[model samples]
Target: MSLRTSLTAFPRQALSRPNWRQTVKTSLVNYGDQRCGMAATAHPVTQDSTGSKGPTAMVFLNMGGPSTTQEVGDFLSRLFADGDLIPLGRLQSYLGPLISRRRTPKIEKQYADIGGGSPIRKWSEYQCAEMCKILDKISPESAPHKPYVAFRYANPLTEQMYTQLLDDGFGRGKGGRAVAFTQYPQYSCSTTGSSLNELWKWRNRLEGKRANGGKEGEGAIQWSVIDRWPTHESLVEAFARNIEEQLATYPEERRNDVVLLFSAHSLPMSVINRGDPYAAEVAATVHAVMQRLNFTNPYRLCWQSQVGPSAWLGAQTSDTVQNYVKKGHADLLLIPIAFTSDHIETLYELDKEVIHEANSPGVKRVESLNGNPIFIKGLADIAAAHMRSGQTCSRQMTLRCQGCTSERCLEQKKFFAGPELSSLVR
Candidate 1:
């Protein structure tokens, strides 16, 4: 149950042999017979006459970062090359490498500032490990909820995770299912959508190839996506609690005077023109958190992580801080509403650059929701919501954003609600 515990190394034969489920089983066995240690201890849940538990694979997706200095360029290249993140039309092939290389040095410096690389993957792994324990406690009757990590643009890529999960017998039978959980608190075409698209592509290409060659429903995973949860009550509570803790640093009387600045990563205007919902969803998250706190102080939502010279969602975080300082607000508490964990954006961009620019005695950055017990409980709540209702993509809570026109998201919703998923309804 400890987040510090490392997943036991997979045996050499697990990778060497063609049998992937056996490989997973071999690896799971190394964690001892206890059901609380590793993610592999969970089995899938299925409905059948035999009453055997159908194994379910839970995959966590995120925008992965470079683990080392040497990998920075590769990470940028993969990120820039993805048409979803940076839409280049036909020029993508020609411009991707150019942009990636041109930005590598400056980006590498930021990574170095944050201790040589981003710890996003490390944090995500720990989150997944801890989440499995929570699932076991809350839903003991369900299939063991095994957790898997899939990154969009780096190591432990989506393809790798999907294949490994499929090999482990998830989505391979009538009762089998796979859950695609987006690590992003809010959804965007560029983040969760892109990751799911990549995942589906792998699913399509490998369908039936593992257990039966090209047979319908043979080796196919019944996928459900947890695309967005900006307004989830538990998540809002976590953010509110974190901000309250940060506020406690100030004198009790002065706390009311502190300006709350909610900062989120910015996306290009081009993406907005194409109807991405990132901006609106981020606003919703900030609003929800503020509501949870019943905050009376003045607050402003701003954007960060604007690369290149292109215009992005605004007002910029740094600029917003300067504006607030100009307005004579001596106290400023910067809350990262769009991010769930600390990484380059929070560690360097906000912590180093924005703080230096603010140059105010009252300026402070709140810690991200990494390994916070309340936040972990919130995530467990999200997983439990999906498990009990057999619902995905948050349709029951909120409608698709008015600005979102993503065909990929539309397709995912249609598929999730179709006859194939009817069996999952509880």
Candidate 2:
């Protein structure tokens, strides 16, 4: 099929009860029927090679890609936004600190399980670099250029890097043509939304800098983003491959016996009750993989990395494992479907916390899947999709469920040009 680029329209708010099952079913069916949207058509999703007036860059940024050292004070301060104490209007502000202080020591101890801190920053850098190289390979024409993967939290983007890309342009470059994309496999109000929020800051700054610089570039420098790829074929195929690899870690005969549990970051019950499609999206991703893998054993979905005083997303892994154990099952496997790589949540939380908490010896070994070729291809698939499609429209375009709300949506932050989501406290 000929390539189809340019999004028909930006996804609006998802309706209250849009039946997530049906939403994902349509995307999966449409994608599987054929590899329809494959070309880097339109203006280019991540990196625009239009050779136009502005630069188009593909930034695979994350919440915490720490290139710079984290500031302990700032982290805590942000953790307790609008000052350390006070029952402010911000629920996350009040609840986050209350939970953080209580959980920090324990969380720190767990983090130590992974040999210090969440090396999320380190791994993010790795993923970004890997993605950059990956995109360069697929787009080739993105020549004389490369995608820049930066962190939004731990390493908060620096002014220099932002200006460099915005000034130089991404798409084709120097011709008011730059395309940007986010590399989150699954969309969440927290992850992909937060990163895009970060980009908007720089975009605003660039507008000011440009005005002051006297219009060196022409026309508006446009940028596009791939918000999330919950059901992209590349993602499902790659996740299946990853699961198969972990199954291989078991004996060939036992592979079939290995029960599958796909876990993503747990959200709050309030959000889900309010209609956050996050849980549904996570389930959708798992479903896609299971469909592709053709799972014979029972497949299940659970929540991981739950936080805050209020109840977070449900069906804790431990609880789920206990259910399995009660069912006369001994061996069980968990796949962290949310995260891109082996971060603190994966290494400590699942591998250590849940394991030891459940079975006497914990899990035989919480299998690890990171930066797999298929997963990388999934990232590439999304980028390529955006390039051909132009916009990142969602199944619930006209409406967004409660959890579908972007944490960065209309939220403003003051960039310190240093690490740590600057002004998170404010």
Best by lDDT: 1
Residue 2 of model 2: what lDDT?
15
TM-score computed on alpha carbons, candidate 2: 0.70
Clashing residue pairs in candidate 1 (N, C-alpha, C atoms within 3 angstroms): 42-144, 43-144, 44-54, 44-55, 44-56, 45-54, 46-54
Residue-by-residue lDDT tens digits, candidate 1, 59-107: 8899989988889999999998988777777999998999999989998
Give the per-residue lDDT digits (tens) of candidate 2, residues 105-183: 6655555556766656544544444555556655554432345655554444534457656545431234343445555
User: lDDT (0-100) at residue 74 of candidate 2?
Assistant: 41
Q: Against the true structure, what is each candidate's TM-score?
A: 0.82, 0.70
Where's the lowest-lDDT run of ten residues in candidate 1? Answer: 1-10
What is the lDDT for 347 in model 1? 94
lDDT of 1: 0.74
